[model samples]
Target: MTFSHDPVEEVARALAASGLLLRGGFSLGEDEAAPAGLSGAPARSILLIGQAGPAPWPHFQRWRERQARDIANPLDSWSREVIGAVAKEFGARAVSPSDRPYLPFQQWAMRAEGLKPSPLGILMHPTYGLWHAYRGALLFENGLGLAEPHAAIHLCDTCVAKPCLKSCPVDAYSGQGFAHEICLGHVRGPHGATCRTAGCLDRNACPYGTNYRYPADVQAFHMAAFAGL
Candidate 1:
């Protein structure tokens, strides 16, 4: 159809219509930050929202253990389709970091963009908690709008005890960053600690966007993958 329209508005409206919430706007410049496939996107605006919940949500600890369900659904179908469309619109393909070839690309996405890796990569967010997840994106030619990322007001910043760093009996998260191997052992090894009991201490400790925590099963599944189970 080749419909001519304001690129940003088109994306915004489309996102809104798809039932994805607009949380905040962020930009990854030529080198500062770029996703796995964003090298090909056209110039377009960035939209941010929690997808379902309003801002100023609760803290992570507030979500109790028994409250979660066993069924796992991350990012929701609507969210996935919307993100896929956005990536395609930008002339790039959305690739999950789990894809072997894209592993380096995923690492680059984090190193280049300052995103920390968590067990949550495979999990999705509901209310921006477990129902939310990021699809490593690449852009071909599309120009993403200049917008600020979701406020760093998330939990990582204000943690006092830093349970994420301390909770892991294996010390998976050293002062520098995630200790991938150690984490794998604890979750996958016969000697591995009971992940279900300890839970994701790091994620659970974070204070920011608590309302965006992943549903329980999703969190466990992601942890298991990181553990290589």
Candidate 2:
């Protein structure tokens, strides 16, 4: 069932009004497993929906202010609502990173955007840097005539200073791995005031996308969520 117009373009237009972008997409090979649809059938292609920077913050805040108090996982909830609407309108299945059993979103992201992970495991985009995020995705039963993701030059490869790894107050990130417990413990302690009020020092240290950095309030919200405060 093909449409006269490009469905991908139509979807992109619809998403733009909400400050979401069609990051990119890929078709699934017959041998590869696909995410199940609402009817429990496999989707043939997936288009990632996300924000490049702080574009969606204002919209999300507006919706958040109108919601009931004590809403758990407010951001995730909001993504589901917005992305779900888009999916419904386009006859697609909506999925989130926080979904149960976790749908390999990181792997999907790397595939879709040709983005390589930074030392912190965040996909670093050339333009958006460490500030972008994958809010949700639209899965279609049939191909949407999406273009293949193109590879970009890795920014970290050329970065000599690598200030991000050194900026952490607790040295949580290292070659071995991220010391999650230590990082969490520090964020919950008294000295965490800086990180709590601003954001992760390491993330802020990234040289790219300074203009696209998340606002202080947004960072605070995420910090509070991270520390379970």
TM-score of each: 0.53, 0.96
The residue-level lDDT of candidate 2 at 91 comes to 82
**Candidates' C-alpha lDDT:** 0.46, 0.89
Judged by lDDT, which candidate is best?
2
What TM-score does candidate 2 reach?
Answer: 0.96
Question: Positional deviation of 210 in candidate 2, in angstroms?
Answer: 1.1
Q: For residues 17-41, could you state the per-residue lDDT of candidate 1 as single tens digits? A: 5444433444556655444445454
Lowest summed lDDT window (length 10), candidate 2:
1-10
Q: What is the lDDT of candidate 1?
A: 0.46
Tell me the deviation in Å of residue 170 in model 2. 0.9
Question: Backbone clashes in each candidate structure, one number apiece?
Answer: 49, 0
lDDT of 2 by residue, 116-197 (tens): 9999889989889999999989888887666778987789888999999999989989998889899999999989899999
Task: Tell me the alpha-carbon RMSD of every candidate.
Answer: 8.4, 1.2
Clashes of 1: 49
